[model samples]
Structure formats: C-alpha cells, structure tokens
Target: MPGRALPVGLCPDMCPAAERDLRERERRLHRLELAPGCPGDPPRADPQRAVKEYSRPAAGKPRPPPSQLRPPPVLLATVRYLAGEVAESAGASPAEVVGFVADRLRAVRMDLALQAAGDAEATVVLEAALATLLAVVARLGPDDVRGPVDPVLLQTQVQESFGSLRRCYARGAGTRPRQAAFQGLFLLYNLGSVQALREVLQLPASLRACPALRTALAIDAAFREGNAARFFRLLRTLPYLQSCAVQGHVGLARRAALARLARALSTPKGQPLPLGFVVHLLALDGPQEARGLCQAHGLPVDEEGRVVFLRGRYAEEGRPPASACRVLVGSKLQGRTLEEVVMAEEEDEGVQAPRTMQEGDAPSPRVPGLAQTI
Candidate 1:
C-alpha cells in the first residue's frame, strides 16, 4: 500500500467541480513556493483582495464609493470646516476656503443636475445646496475679510448654480410646479441674462404678479428701453436680497453702456465726449464719477472733463470682460440703438418722455418712482 501509485484522473473523478478547482489552485500555489516558510503558513491573499486591501481607506474611517456619495453633505462638511477655522488656524485664507467650497459646490451642482434628470429628491437636495451657497456668499461680505476677496469666481459659480437650479426646475415642472418658475425668474434676473429674462416675461400673469418677478421684469424693461435714469432708480429700490444679488451685474450693465457709447462716439481723430453726456448716458451721479469710471476703464479724459475716444481699432480691445454682459443685453434688445429703444417705448406707451431728465428720475411710465414698488 505504501508503494502503490494513485490511479490517473482519480482526483477529477472523485471530487466535485469546485473541489477540483480548489485542489488544483492549491497545487499550483504550492509549486510556486520556494520553500516551506513555516510548518503552517497563513493562507495567501487573493490578488484582487490584496489590491482592494491596499487601496482601501485607512482603518476605521471607511468612505462610501463615489456612486453612493451625496454632494450636499460633502459641501456642508467643507463649509463647516471653514466655519471652525480661526485666523491662526492651520488652514487656507477665508477667501481661499470660500472659493474652494464654491468650486466643490459647483461640481456638486453638475452632479445634482445629472441626478435631477431622473430623481426628484436630487432636485430638492440641489436647491438646499444652492441655498447653503447663497448663505455662504452673504456671510463672506466684502467687509468681512482682512484681505480682499475676489468675488468673481464665487459669482461665476453662483451663476452656474442658478443654471443648474433652472434645469432642475424645468425637469420638475409636472410634479413640483410654480416654485421652480419663480425661483428661476429670480436666478435669471440675478444672472443678468436678458434673453432669458425676456422669455420668462411671457409666463402666465400670476408669475408676473410676484413682487420679485415684477421687479425683475421692470428692471429688464428699463434696461432694454435705454432708460438709464429709470434703470438706476429701480436698481436702487430692489428688494434687499435682489439688491445684493444684482450688485455685480448692475455694474456690468453700466460698463457695457459706456463701452458702446465709446465705440459709437469715438472717431479716428480724438473727439472728446462731454462728461455730462457720458454721465447721463451711463446713469452716473456726475461728471466726477463719470471721469472716475472712464479712468477705471483706461479711457482717457481731458482736463476739461471730456472722455477722449481712442484713435482706432485698439478701442474695442480696451473694453473689459464685464462689457460682454452689456453686449449680450444690447443684442437681446434687438440691436436697437439706445435712443431708438427708449423713444419707441415712449411712443408706443403714449407717454411723453421726461422733457428734462434729472439724476435718479424715472425715465418713463414703466419705471416706478423712488417710493413706488416695482
């Protein structure tokens, strides 16, 4: 019995398929072993298991797979971390932290957009995240930081978040309803998207009745009709939240008007635009402010308080990025010369244009007086 050889294929005949596979694997593993490291060595780790073990997060701090992640929680964590940090804390500046959080929220926004395509719950979460972001912006006011914070990126992310909100609202129209419409109206106005604003104006009368919607519509009207006097008045009277939201865009709109005026009034030879004219056109307080704005934009102003239009092709390039919003607004107004739009609105409404416009006055009937709500 000791000298007897086992029959060929006996193991395969005697064992089940799974047992045979295990035995064969064990035999191959044994063959690869250089030596018996110990009388009973621990079982070798599976190759896949080994990789997973190495890749796994640190012990006791398991993270959900990315597919299972919910963005709002991540965003909240980032915000909370920043909120807890102090001046001497080992962390980024408040501005940097805010910017980083904004970027993360924007990414979450895109994720929300995708999720909202198929799930209503995702839409709700997206809105909550957006609200959180808006609060973050409010808390990081210009005066809050010791160092200057560039709100440009934060503003951009907010605008993009509004876009995501808009999409979610559109998708949830059937199950959700008027809420999305009104919120979207606010967002489109905040974004200063004139074309979108016009489209929304075509919504039902009930939406038009909302104070915020009414305000946004009036602003759009004032801007489109070239009623700088009226637009500025309405801009100042905006509801508290809307006022803060549109501060950047209002500046952008004014800058755009200035750029257009420059291009229109500039001649190949130096022609100075009257400071008074520029002020009235851009809804500025006075020639001094007009001069300041011109200087800020690199437009030369003579000692006589007249803006000297640049000589040639270089003039267009002189405009800032904010001018793009102005151009977009202008195009949305159907390329009407500012005067034409203003005059046409006045004529069509059977209302006489103000004989002599003054600072902070309503330009037409569509614009409310200083004390009047939009």
Candidate 2:
C-alpha cells in the first residue's frame, strides 16, 4: 500500500494517519456549529423558552423590592390637585371639570398600573384613585356632558374602573364599605342587564343587605318589569352619589315607560292625558317638560296642555327632555361641592355604620310628601 497509490477518496479509510486527520476535521466542524452566531443548522429550541430566558434578570441582579417602589410623582400631584383645587373650583362647568378630571385620572391609572405591582400601599392608592374617578364620572347624566368623548364611552370607562376596583377588592386592597357601595352603584348603572343583577345576587349576604344595594335591586326589578311608577318612585329615594350613578339611565327608562303608556292609552279617537299626570309618572320637572317629552315622541299636545295619544301614531323618535328635575336628585347634594360628594365615604371609621336590613325586613318608608306630590 506504501508503494501503490490508494484510491483518491479511499486513502482516509485505508491509512490510519489519513483517517485520524479526517476525524479531527469532522470534530472541528461540529464544535463550530455549536458556537454562538456561527452559521449552520440552528439548534432546535423552543422560541418561548428562549424569550423567557432573555427576559429573566441577569444572575445576581434581582429586581428592586416592592417596598422600595413608590407611585409616580405626577400621580401623587394629580390626585392632590383633584382633591383640593379642582374640587373647590366654582368657575368651571360640570362638563369641563369632569373632562379635565377624566384626562388626569386616566394618566394616574396608567402610571399606577406600571408602578404599583406587588406594593400593597400603592395598590390602595390605586383603589382610591379609581374610586374618585368613578365618582366624578357618575356625577354627570348621560347627555349632560358631551365633547370629544361620547357619553357611552364614559360609561364604559366607569365599568372598566369598577371592574378593576373589584379585582383589587378580591385581593383585599379596598375597604369593604367602599367596595360594597361601588358594587351597588355598578348594579344601578347597568340596571337593564341581567348580568348586573346576577353579580349582585352572588354577593355575600352582608353586602347584598347594604341599603344602596337593596335599593338598586328594587330599581332593577321595577325597570325590568316596566313599572314606570315604581321605577320613578324608587329613583327618588337614591342618595346624591347613587343618583349620579343611576342618572345616565333615566332617559332610557323614561322613553321605555312613555312607550308603554302610549301603547296602553292610545285609542281610535285620541285620548287626552293630563300633562301633570305624565310629569308625576316620569318624575319630570313640570308640565312644560312633560309636554316636550310628549311632543318628542310624536304625540300632540292640546291647548289645555293635555297630551293626545292616538293609536298607531306613536313615533319612536326625538330625544327625551334634558333632565331638569334638580329637586329630586341633584339638590340632594345639599350645597356640597362635587369633590366632597364624590370623595366622601358613607361609612368612614368613627362615622355611623350604614343601615343593614335583615332578610325579611321591609324597606324603609318612602319620603312621605313625595307620593302626595304625584
């Protein structure tokens, strides 16, 4: 084999030294393929696993402790401003105040979400912030505040904020009283939805017994049953903040109730219903608003200020009268500024506890003169 030349490609297999060199070359290629960034068939690896590894903190460089984390400076400032100066400002219209507050609260919420992770104190702050925001939003009626933001969008934000607050409560972040109150408000705001009622029913017996929640449940029942009389009656009993929470739905409730009335009262020869009766039934400000509402829905008003309901003539058109019944709900604020109305908790420590009812107990009597007014 030394004297005779081996086949060109067979030398490595035929000679020991050639075979050793070939083995060494193969080993070098294998090592090169395994090295970082070297061009070869990439190692089969899970992409998610790689991402997790990359995202993980480097060894010996742990994350800062939750105790060291503080809320953003802007968040603190904004909250203080909202609670103090803005709350007391008398010159700004309700819409303007709410729009500004909404913008600031949105920023505060975003900052809290980023910085409040794992920090109990910061989470509590977030709860308060959300509560304040919800309160501000609840103060405005559905059509009362209009601008770039749609009224429906504001309601959506309220729902989202309340949901976040509930999540916080589930983690034991907010006080029970505040959470209970907001839960009731949530039910009232979503009066027409069965889901809201289901959520309320699923609550603990103690929470379900809160006065606000109880009233909310009654209102929901009346609304679902299309009992306009009972719906307006129950509506008159809500506290100022609760009224704000429920005000957004008042127009819809009124429209639906008016439709029912039209269907029931309409006759071949139009029937004349007193404007005063419509006012009492809908809790409107007075005869003028009642007339407006009747006209809005295509009903005719007579010289004597009576609405003529004609069969097959009721048109489901026109906007409902703007809420003008300040005496019923808005006046309940009793000269308190919007901020005080919003930020004040009904059951603060050392304050009187909310009235709780037993399962079989009847609701407290309605304001005596309210019924007579009708």
Candidate 3:
C-alpha cells in the first residue's frame, strides 16, 4: 500500500479552513461572473488584498463599540441601492440620482466622523459606498443630468465629504487608483487643498496619467500663478464629471476674484469704480447684475454707474464681512442622543444640580445597610 499524493491546496499541512473559504469565494464569484445581466464587481489585481485593506481598521482611533456604529450596515445598504440605481437608470438622467446618492454617502460620512476617529473598517465600508456613487456619476453625460441644487453649495458639501473620505480611506488603499485620483481632484478643485492633490499625483505613475488629474493639475497651476484668464479657460474645458464636480465652487471662486479686484482698485474715501469695470472683474452678465451683487454686499454704486468697495466698512457696521459669513453647516443635531438634548436644555435653563446628601444629613431610609450604619 502507498500513500496518495494530496492536491496542492488540499494538503493537511496547509490551511484547510482558509483553502475552503477561498474556494467558496471563488465559486460565488465565478457564478456571479457567468450569471446573465449581472454587472459583476470590477476587476481587482488582488481581491483578497482588497478585502483585507478594507476590513482592517486603521489604528489611532478607539474601536467604536459595535452597537454604536452603523456605517458598516448602512454603507452596505447604500452600495446595494446605488448599484441597483446605476443598473436601472439607463433612460433616466443620472445627475439628480447621483446627487441624491452622494447626499446619503455624505450623511453617513459625517455620522462616522462624529462618533470617533473612524477605524479602517468604517473607511472600507464608506469606500465601497463611494465606489458605487462614483460609478453612477461616471455614467452621467455632460447634459444628461442637471445639478440637483445650487452648484456652489453642492461643491462645498462635496469638498468636505470627499476630502474626509480621501483622508480616511484613500490613503490606505492601493488598488483604487482611478477612483482615488478623481476624488483627489474633486477635493482639490472644490476645497483647493493643494497638498491633497499633490499626494494623489504622487501615487503610482499609472494613476497620475489620468486625464482628470492632468486637467486638475493645470487648473491648480493657473490658480496658483494668478492666471485668472487661463484658470477660467481650463475650467471651461473640464470633462463632464469635472465640470459638474467643480460647479459649486465656481461662484465662490468668482466672488474671491471680485474681492481681489476690489482690493487692487481701492482708493481713499469717495473713490469709485465704473460699473462696467466691476462687471468685467466679477464676470457678471452685465452692469445691472454687478450692481445688484454690489448692493447686496454693501458695495454701494453711485448715481453715475460707479461702485465703491469701502474697506473695513463691515466692521464699522458691526457685521461680519461677506467672506466671513459663508458658513458651512457640518451636521444637524437630529441624530444626537436624548441625553445630550436633555443636558443642552438643562444648560439653557440654568438648572442647578440636585444637592447630594452629605455625611451629616439625616438618613431615614428603611434600607438594611444604610439604616444599620446610621
């Protein structure tokens, strides 16, 4: 009698449980790949590494108690929902739907941030949800979907949400080059984080060659060099996704340019700038629009169609300057614990703490331990 030769993966000396699990996963994936109408998951260089990268929690944050964290399940649900939407949205416009999905993703992201410095587990979940969102957004054409809200406001939201994700998840995942690059550019243009964009460019050469990355880098250079004309030109030629992604920040950028123009052309009291000059500087449609913008911001226009930007005037009027008032709302208190709300209410009411019984105080309880001590 002779011992039989074991198959390579089935040997008892190797990991039997792991080999079985691997086989099971491969079986499922193979079924998925062969299934009709199943848009299977994207090709990964190493699927197991992908799983580990996402599942392993980043150190430095306390692992949140399982009961307190919803990101894993919530993001899983969101990914499934968005994947379905992406598959079914063949005839409909994707912009609004994508925006809706982005909103949900952002909400989950904010919730994760508030609870703790999220671990890698949460980031992995969020990244999966974001991947689905990116997929939906990628399917959109230039005019296929219009912005769901004011473009400027949406840019602000995307900046915060996407930037946070890039920081938490993108830094660790080496497999998501294209998605990471796009998100990095999104954060750079909307939030103007040069450091973030640079880091993305410093990624593997394969990713740096992305057209979106190149365009974003050019825009950054133009902006940094004070080449407003070039900046605007590059902005005009942004890809469909980049154009939509940067739309929200365009108004902010224009306003900033207007402020710079005002500062450059400032003169002593009573000096005025021609309304046409103001219009051109602000890139407004006409003198009337420029006049309206000036009036709204306390930059008064004279009867002769000349405008004056009074420096330090907002301080004199006991109000914050316009730039200071562009507040970004981070989150609402709707999800806060009832105890937090009660404590806040108590503080507002100036309630004092109930006095505790001191050692000298009377103890009249019928409890065995306290009565015996007394």
- Best-performing candidate as measured by lDDT: 2
Ordered list by TM-score, greatest first:
2, 1, 3
Better of 1 and 3 by lDDT: 1
All candidates' TM-scores? Answer: 0.45, 0.67, 0.40
Off by over 4 Å in 1: 1-95, 107-125, 131-160, 171-195, 244-248, 259-289, 296-317, 321-374
* Candidate 3 clashes between residue pairs 3 or more apart in a chain or in different chains: 57-120, 58-120, 151-248, 152-248
Model 1, position 190, has a per-residue lDDT of 58
TM-score of 1: 0.45
Q: Write one digit per residue (lDDT tens) for candidate 1, span 64-119.
A: 33343334444333333323321113334545545544554554454333221343
lDDT of each: 0.46, 0.60, 0.45
lDDT of 3 at 103: 58
lDDT (Cα) of model 3:
0.45
Model 3 TM-score (2 dp): 0.40
Better of 2 and 3 by TM-score: 2
Highest-scoring model, TM-score: 2
